[model samples]
Target chain A: MGTFLIVDDDESLHKVLVRVLKLEGHKVVGSVYNGSEAVEFIRNSKTKPDIILMDHRMPVMDGTTATREILALDSTQRILFISADETAESEALKAGAVGFLLKPIRSADLFRAVKSCLGEK
Target chain B: MDPMQIAWHLMEGTNDIITSINKDGTFSYVNRALMEKLHYSESEIDTLSIGTIFFPGEQKKIKAIVTKDTHEIISDVQTIMVTKEGEMLHVEGAFSPFFEGGKKVSTIALFRDISKQKKMEEDLERERNQTEFLIDIMTHDLANIHQEIISMLDFLILNEDLPNETVGIIKEGISEIERATRLISSVRKISIVSKALPDLQCMDISLALLRGAIQARLAFPEKTLKLVTDVEHGEYFVVADEYLVDIFYSLLHNSLKHSKKKDVTI
Candidate 1:
């Protein structure tokens, strides 16, 4: 399992995700609230997560902007958008996202999509 | 400058074939643009009729517009014509009647080479013909690969005699894969229907949404439905076409498939 950095606005998701991800033998390196925080974290941090789950909606910055900023910092960054919004597909794809897990993503899919992005599958 | 001098300069400078033909369709005047593109010298092309460029039997269309009464400008349209090297070139432009004394004595035609657009269209048509091959890969070939993972999961769960908890998780994973495959099949059907480009019809969209929820229930037996409309339920007429139900099915399925919550409110 790969190390994941989750960027979602919903605080409730952080606990549930950690519980589900830890059970799958994956590690959650960090969790951020908005796109700006994610960008800041990625840029300033020493150890980077293997895959990032970017949320489509947020308070300060959206996932697409965060994805763009992170990629600009490091082109090899692997980021995904797990969104419930149907209209997010085109925007997510346009932002150079590697994969998208439509919400409410099951435990198995979250694992699979992460592994796929990590080049494990 | 004199009128003839200005006319000559305009004809020679533009990036189009400008030629005036006689009433009998024999070329009377040829511009530099025409000579350059058709690879014909001025004197040689003046002897050639406009009919020389027309594709075989298609010359009759030009010839039929013989009299002043029948003369009209043929506007931007695409047609095939033989170039100087006998290569078929797609030309897109117009042809207009030239009058000497308020009576049409000849015609002047302007055309630009459009072989690039024609080539692109031909390539697209070729790819479009391979739709069945694409569908085959999406459905049949892809399913084979998916089945391999499933069979491996099955072997591990059954033959190896794993712990009950581990086996249950494996089964859950397999079910997820199965769900994904079913989604792919549904996507394929919808993709094919959408590509066919059905005509749009006005219908009660609220009714369609209600019917679509019913369809989703039928399609996925395990999934429960609780469709709530933001608007009051009534005859909500909308400009939509076929597969209105499929649209709702896709939207409704996404929420159901991934939601950890028992009761969804979308």
Candidate 2:
């Protein structure tokens, strides 16, 4: 199990995802509303999350911009983008996200992605 | 004044560019409309040949029109005419051979500007293409997302130890999203049919319906749904595509899934 952070605009998504990951025995580090908030959380928080589930297309800032800023703050922080828009795939990768996953993901797949970030086989 | 002089004044008053070109392809007479359109004085036009009046690359089409021998006037021939500043002017007109004293002397042609009309047509085409593209993306991508949402909700319901009330809410959410997905797919199918009308072909629709029935039965092995059709077996031809089968399958599926009866004829 790994520590994970959730950054998405939809509060309902955050609730369901947090509950699902928690049920799988992963630590729920924090939740941020958008890219800018995620960057702020990463900067201020002393204990950084092992992985970040970043969502593309948010109000304050988007996942790509936040990922770039967060990576600058901490180069090794693992960030995986979860987006419904496939058009933003290239931008997500360019911003240094480890992977891109489309939304409505199963809990098992989400757990698997978290494990992968933790370097599990 | 002679009868021909009065006729010339009447020709000059019309909006269209009227010109009479000699058999040698030189301008015999260019009306006031023609001179105004190209910003050319009568003396300037007198010095220019018919070939010089039209830009190159239009020569072949112009030649075909000028050389054709027919008693009837040929209408709707599009040609490019050049302005004084060398700008292309789009025009459509009729070419009629003029005769003098029982001998063919020149070809009389009338040109009307169609540039604005063409531009409007092009804009409408672009708008239509854009709308189709957007509908396609919404149907394909949005439906996929909706499917994913339902899948997640189903898994959560199955695996989680949630309260009965919470599970009820989740199930309700799932049904609503499914309905939304079906509506989107229906709209997308409509757009697809409109955009792909040319792909329609004549085929035996009976075979397609039978296949749809078999697929529907396989999809719902537990449900007793009968596919009822009055189509004969010889050859029921239909100008359609694979989507026709999908339409039948969806109808059968929806009928069976919604009806309260254990055995429903669809």
Candidate 3:
């Protein structure tokens, strides 16, 4: 089981992703609204999550810039971008995101991506 | 008949308006069609000019075209003109520089009234914008709502230790949510067809069928479905997108809905 930090503007999604991750035997370490909070969460936390579920569109900061910032702080940080916008897939990947999942993501697909990010078979 | 006379007769007989304006925007010549459409008589022609004929809002634009320096034809210049009654008339026409003794002196303009076409085009654009706006709400906002419901259902299915029948019912509810999501996706695809092409990739047809079967079974939990196919997963591939799964799901859902037998094999 892996640990995850959920970052998304949608509160409904945060609840769902956290519950789904917990149901699948993974720990949701933290949840934040935007990318800037996510950066702050990672910077202050003593124990970082194994994977970060990043969202693209947000009010204060976007996922791409946040991904770049967090990865700059720690290159080993794993980020999996989850967004409703399909166009953000390439941008997320280019910004040091390990994976990109479009929104309305099935729990199965989300698990697969998380497992892949964790380097699990 | 002389060709010049025939040409003049043709210009006079056509429904298209023809008028020549001097450098100072004064009417040099006005065809019968122009005079009749603009409600100007030969006696009143001296009082009319480019400024008097063009719609008030369109005067500067029309004047620029009429007084342009180009000898080349300015084609399909769409603008509004005002009739004697002050009614706006949509027109699209061409302007040609009229030269005398190798010096440009006036502009000869020919116009066809397109008020009906313009109204129809504007109505269509308004309707299209409204449709796209609704589709945006459905795809983004409504889609999130659907996702929330699906997630709730999924959570119940995994966490709740309910009876087998209750779990089946919950699964059916999730399937209904998926169906609604598919409808929203279909509307999104239709709206974006003119904007961008579909993203097609090499998809495993068998996998799509399997996924469809699983989701379809969720919709009919009371029924025992046995999908018997010779095709193996990853063996058969087709150029398709995620819509392929939607198609398969729709077909299987219809088949299951119409079937009378509780236990069906396909």
TM-score chain B for all models.
0.72, 0.67, 0.73
Model 1, B1-266: lDDT tens per residue?
Answer: 99999988999998777777677878778778767776778568755775787677656766655444545788886667776787777778777887777788887777788889889989987786687457645664444445445545655664466787898777777777766665766666565665676668887788778776765555444446777767556647878775686688777877676777666556
- Best by the TM-score measure: 3
* Interface RMSD, in order shown: 12.4, 5.0, 2.0
How many angstroms is residue A32 displaced in model 3 relative to the true structure, after the best TM-score fit?
A: 4.9
Give the candidate number with the greatest DockQ: 3
Give the worst 10-residue stretch by lDDT in candidate 3 chain A. A81-90
TM-score of each model, in listed order: 0.53, 0.52, 0.66
- Tell me the lDDT of candidate 2: 0.78
Off by over 4 Å in 3: A1-7, A22-52, A55-79, A83-97, A106-108, B1-15, B21-27, B30-74, B79-90, B96-106, B159-161, B194-249, B262-266
Sorted by TM-score (best first), the order is 3, 1, 2
Worst 10 residues of 1 chain A by lDDT: A101-110
- By summed lDDT, the worst window of 10 consecutive residues in model 3 chain B runs over B136-145
* Candidate 3 clashing pairs, residues 3+ apart or interchain: none
The TM-score each candidate achieves on chain A is 0.94, 0.95, 0.96
List lDDT for all candidates, in order. Answer: 0.73, 0.78, 0.84
